[model samples]
Target: MNKISIGQSELMASQISLGIMRMNALSVEEAKTVIETAISEGIDHFDHADIYGKGASETIFGQAFKKLGISRDSVILQTKTGIVPGIMYDFSKEHIIQSVEESLTRLQTDYVDTLLLHRPDALIEPEEVAEAFDELEKSGKVRTFGVSNHNPLQIELLKKFVNQPLIINQLQLSLTHTPMIDAGLNVNRTEAGSVLHEGQLIDYSRINDMTIQPWSPFQSGNGKKGLFFDHPDYLELNKVVNEMAKEKGVAREAIAIAWLLRHPAKMQPIVGTMNPDRIKAITKTTEISLSREEWYKLYLSGGKMLP
Candidate 1:
């Protein structure tokens, strides 16, 4: 797997990261295999959230990771906070500090490589967040800070007060779910794709040097729509993906991941699959690069119209 410098920071991470959101369902042994497989495949970055499996995922990963006896510095661990599940999104100083303390305990680590504010808090006070970040940085609880699911202005708002550079913005992006890309490509058009839902985040992120961590790299769209592979709405997409996979002699998942990696944005996609076999297959994305035309073909095949 290729490595890229995350934002303007010194944190060099793998091009593809493994999301441990589903690791809670796996036993310690199973989780150990998954983590070991990912590490063997050069995936040194692991993404987690405090809300994932109600924190069970982190606990399992910690136990499994400890059992592996690998050096803590060998792999980068990134996790998110600010989401209280059904309650509300809280970026309060107390909540933010408490979340990290709890996450550190669950992860069985002294500090996280990166910590992201899981979601935008509508009631966010940038001052409180800044204070929390200052403390976290000074105390060595978090190495760096970023946000998830935030638009450019939201990031700007945080940037105004937060002293640290917001180095990353994790968002939902895949072949079929590309509002950020669509809004850019369909500029000035009357189509629904022209709607700027994310305030031109792709451009903003690049200009600001914020790495965009694309999550749900296989989902059809937001919510319970499911994966695009073999989905009824993505028959054409599956055809193109399958044909490309056949030509490249790689799994269809690799093609999907390659499409994201092909972008100049240098996106680090978070593959959420826990299957060791699938993890190995997905890592093949680093072995192949899609041509410009092939990349567009996939975009079109995913049911997008290029203006």
Candidate 2:
């Protein structure tokens, strides 16, 4: 795997991050296999969230991670907070502090290299978030802070008080779910105003040097059902992906992953698969390069062009 600097920081992280959200259902032995497989493939960056599997995933990892007993410094432990049972958001100082403590307890770690606010809280108090982060940083509980699914303005709003740099933003990205990638596809039209987050998240992160970790890189949902891997509407795009994969002698899925990392922004595509072979395949994007024409061909086939 290739290393990319996370955000503006000098810390180098693997381009492909591993998500352990689904391991809650896997047996301890099974979880170890999946995690160990990732380690074998040089995937030391693991993503976690507090509410995943109702906290069962963290517990499972705590056990497996402890058993493996890799020194805490060897891995980059990143997680998120703020989505709870009520479908509401919470950036309350108490919740943030408590959440990190619980996550550390569950993940068997002393501190998280990065903690992301899961989503924007409509009523967020920048000061309260600041307060929580201040303490977390001072106590060495959280080394860095960022947000997930947040836009540019929201992050700027937090910066008014958040003393530490919020240097990362978790985004939902896939070959088919390319709003961030496609927002600028049409510049002369007024419709660009209607795009979610206004593409500012991508532009802002790039200019500000924030790392973007994309979840669900291979979901078959962007066309008939919704990003462009398996849905019926993307048959043509799929054909192109297959053709490119055959030409490059790599898996189509690997081609899909390469398309994202090839962007100048240096996005880190986080995969949710527990499959070892798949993890090995996707991370190989760090080596493959796509031609500009091949990249745009898939995007155009995903949508109507000149129609």
Candidate that would win on TM-score: 1
Per-residue lDDT for 1-307 in model 1, tens only?
8999999799999999999999999999999999999999999999999999999999999999999999999999999999988889999999999999999999999999899999899999999999999999999989999999999899989999999989999999999999999999998999999999999999999999999999999998745488999999889999999999999999999999999999999999999999999999999999999999999999999888888
Question: After aligning candidate 2 to the native by TM-score, how far in Å is the CA of 240 from where it should be?
Answer: 0.9
Off by over 4 Å in 1: 222-224
Per-prediction TM-score? 0.99, 0.94
| Model 2 C-alpha lDDT per residue in residues 1-307, reported as the tens digit of each score | 8878898665778888898889898988888888888888888898999998888898898788878767778788888999886878999999999999999999887899999999899989999999999999999999988989998888999999999988889988777676776565545565743355445567778888898888877765444353456667778878888888888888888998888877888888888887778877776766789888877787677663521
- In candidate 2, the residue pairs with backbone N, CA or C atoms under 3 Å apart (3 or more residues apart, or in different chains) clash, namely 176-227, 221-226, 221-227, 222-226, 222-227, 223-226
Q: Local error of candidate 2 at 284, Å?
A: 2.1
With a 3 Å backbone cut-off (N, CA, C), the pairs that clash in candidate 1 are none
